[model samples]
Structure formats: C-alpha cells, structure tokens
Target: MRIFRFSLLTLCLLLSSIISFTLYAANDWYRPPVAVSWYWQLNGTVNENHDVDLYNIDLFDSSAELIQRLQASDKKVICYFSAGSYEDWRPDADQFAEKDMGKTLSGWDNERWLDIRSTMVHQVLLRRLDLAVEKGCSGVALGEVDSYRTNTGFYFRQDDQLRFNHIMAEEAHQRGLAIGLVINADQVRELVDYFDFALNEQCFEYSQCSSYGAFIKNEKPVLNAEYRRIYVDDKEERNSMCQNALTLQFSSILLSKKLDGSLYKPCR
Candidate 1:
C-alpha cells in the first residue's frame, strides 16, 4: 500500500511538471520578432538571399508546399489574410454572411467591410486562424482591421475597434502565432500596443511614417509598402526612399499595384 501511494504521487508530480513546461514552451514559441520581406505578385519567385527573416505571401496564392520550401530555406513565413473584410474573389467568400458585411471598402470594389461586432464574423476569423496554423504559417498579417475608422456602415465606434483589435491579437496569440496589425496612419497610436508588428501602406508617401516610430522604439519591426510608380522609374526617388528607410531602420519595399511577385527594390 505504501509503495503504491508513493508511485501515484510521483506520477502526479511528473505530469504537473510536463504540463507546466509545455505551457512555457508554447508561450515562448510565438514571441520571436518578425523581419519580413513581402512579395504580393505571382510572377517572379521569391529571392531567398535578401537576408530577410520572413516572407509574407498570399495565403491562397501560395500553397503549403511553397511555404514549406521557404521554411526549409530557414525563413519564417507570415500568411496574409483579410480578416476584417469580405473579399468577393476569395475561395471562402461564400462562407461570410451577408448581414455580417457592411459598406464596400472605399476605392476597393470587390471587398466590403465586415461587422467586427458580429459573432459570425468572429467565427469566420477564428477559422481563418486555424487555416493559418494548419498551413504551417509562423504568423498572420490581418489586413484592414481599422474598419471602424472608415465609413464601414456599421456605426462602429473607437471603443468597438479597440475591442475587436484586442480580441484578434489575443486569438492569434492563443494559437501560438504572432499577429500583425495593418492600420491606417491615424489609428496607429491606439492600435500599436495590441499588435506584435505593423504593416503600413504608403506612410512614407504621406509623411506619416514618423508616427509609427513607436513600434521601432519597442524593438518591433514596421514593414512599409510604397506603390508609387516614381520609385520604380526614377533612380533619384528610389535612392531617397532607400536612404530614409535605412535611417529609420524600417523595411520598405516598392511593389506594383497588382501585388503580383514583381518587386522593384527593397530599402534595407
């Protein structure tokens, strides 16, 4: 009887230790800093020798095999998905409820804003995160999360946006993946704290790049994309952008409007 009691206690202690260690290890897995080179176009193959730490690619456009290939080359992959908007062209577009969708995204015809407050939208996003994990993605870039600030037709307030963004971050973290926030320049101050990193579009073009310095200050990288044609045609503009990016320590890339795999240049 004494021996059996001792054995049971030992088994319980071992199980507890294993559980604690697993939890710690899981927390450490998703906390690594991200340094990504983005390729949205489908034409040219990814240049694996750019000294970049990560590659952000379209979740649907690039297959799991391609992501595995990049990882085999010792690069982390961040899968890009539109979490807060309903894109009509996506394969999973039919899954979104019509009532959960709001106004069409300004300047974007094929996409519409999603009601962040809707439980249905949350369920869809959770499935998307699950898809990311299943596809072997190291992290996720949740695009267009600032719908509340726009004319989303949902009558969303700032507090609602904050709640939704925080929930998104928490859900990503829970899945052992880092989440990046792609927000307009105006909401950076409010949403920066909830995101692991940031993906900003045309901040340099608008002279709002300085507003995102907080992320760099916190040792988090800010990946900026510029879509201006001059950056590609004019050597002078490219030089200036490169110099500015180098000084700011921000990873900047000039991409075409199509987001097809054509990368003009990278500002290191």
Candidate 2:
C-alpha cells in the first residue's frame, strides 16, 4: 500500500508539470521573439525565398496560396493593413462613409485618415481582422495607428488613440492572432503590453528609435526600416547603420521608400 501511494503521487506531479508547461506554451501563441528575422514586402512580387522567420506582406494583395506557401516553408506571415486610414483602392473602400473619413494623407492622395472612434470604422477593422484569420496569417501589422498625432481633421486626443489601439489588440488576440504596433512610437510605453511586436519606419533617421525600448525591455521584436537614400547608396554607411541597429537589438532593414521588395539589407 505504501509503494502504491508513492507511485500515485509521482504520477500526479508529472502530470501537473506537463499541464503547467502546456499552459505556458499556449500563452505564447503567435508572439515572435526579440530580433526575429523578417521580410517586409508590401508591393511587387513576394519572393518567399528570403530565408526569414517572418514575412510582413499586404493583407489585401497577397493571395491565400502565397501565404500558405510561406507557411509550408515554416515561416510566419504578418498581414499588413492600414487600420487608421481609408484607402479608396481597396475592395472594401466603398464601405467607408464620407463622414467617417477625415483628412487626406499628406503625400498619398488616395488614402485619408479615419475616425478611429466611429462605429462603422470599428466594424470595418474587425472584418479585416477576420480576413487575416481566414487567410491563415499568424499576425497583423496595423499601419496609420498614429493618425491621432497627425492633422487628421478629427478632434482626436491621445486618450482616443489609446482606446482604439487597445480595442485592436484585444480583438486580434481574442481571435488567436498576434498584433504588431506600427509607427505610433509615442504610444509604445502605453501599448507595449497590449501588442506582440512592432514595425517602425524612419525611426532611425528621425531619432525616434529610442521610443521602442519598451518592446526590447519586454523581449518583443522591434522591426525597423530606414528609407534614407544614404543607407541604400553607401555601403560603408549601411554597415555602420546596421552595427548601430544590432547594438540596439533591433531587426533592422534598409529598403526603398516604396517598400516594393526591391532592396533588402537586413542587420544581422
């Protein structure tokens, strides 16, 4: 009887350990580690042979087959979409109402800022999230989330932006998808806990790269892009820039301003 009791206790302890480990793993879900290699191709043909850990591509432009192909190669896909802007070129563009759109983007004529507080906009963004799940994307990179900081023509404040960003992160996680905070560097301290990773543009050029230290502190990946012509044309400068990126523990890439998959220099 004594031997049987000891055996039972050991079994129980082993089972408990297994269960605890499983729960810990399940909690990790789609969150990528810090400094994960990635390919950010929002335009042109997607070359999946880049041998990267993650691929950030257009949610609307990439076909389901392409995303599946990447997954077959054991790569994770992060779909990109403008969550805070209404682009007239998208298939769902007509769904946005005139009242929900604010000011047009400074350089992009076809795109306009969205009223992040609008019910219609929320519904649209939710639908987009659903599409990401349907397409088998492991995560999403929500662009234009910092419209509140711009002259969006709406009476938006920081509080409104925080609320909207929280809703987005909650919705993505509830659907079993990771969400990447894009370019709202100012909100990193507030939204870091809510997001899985981050993608930034021109932060290195504009001296805003330090804003992403919160993500580094949490061991989340911070993928940055530098579009300055010097980074592209000069090899010595590119090498120096990449060293700086490495010191910062950022997975940095030097790409064209268009992000057309033409030039890719990863800081390994």
Best by TM-score: 2
Cα miss at 137, model 1 (Å)? 0.3
Query: Whole-model Cα lDDT per candidate?
Result: 0.78, 0.92
Q: List the residue pairs that clash in candidate 1.
A: 40-259, 41-259, 41-260, 41-261, 42-260, 42-261
RMSD per candidate (Å) reads 4.3, 7.8
- The CA-based lDDT of model 2 is what? 0.92
lDDT of 2 by residue, 11-111 (tens): 99999988876665447459899999999999899988999999999999999999999999999999999999999999999999999998989998999
lDDT of 2 at 36: 96
lDDT of 1 by residue, 149-232 (tens): 788878998888888888888888777778888755666777777677888888888898998888887777788889898999
Residue-level error in angstroms, candidate 1, position 27: 2.2
Residue 248, candidate 1: C-alpha displacement in angstroms? 1.3
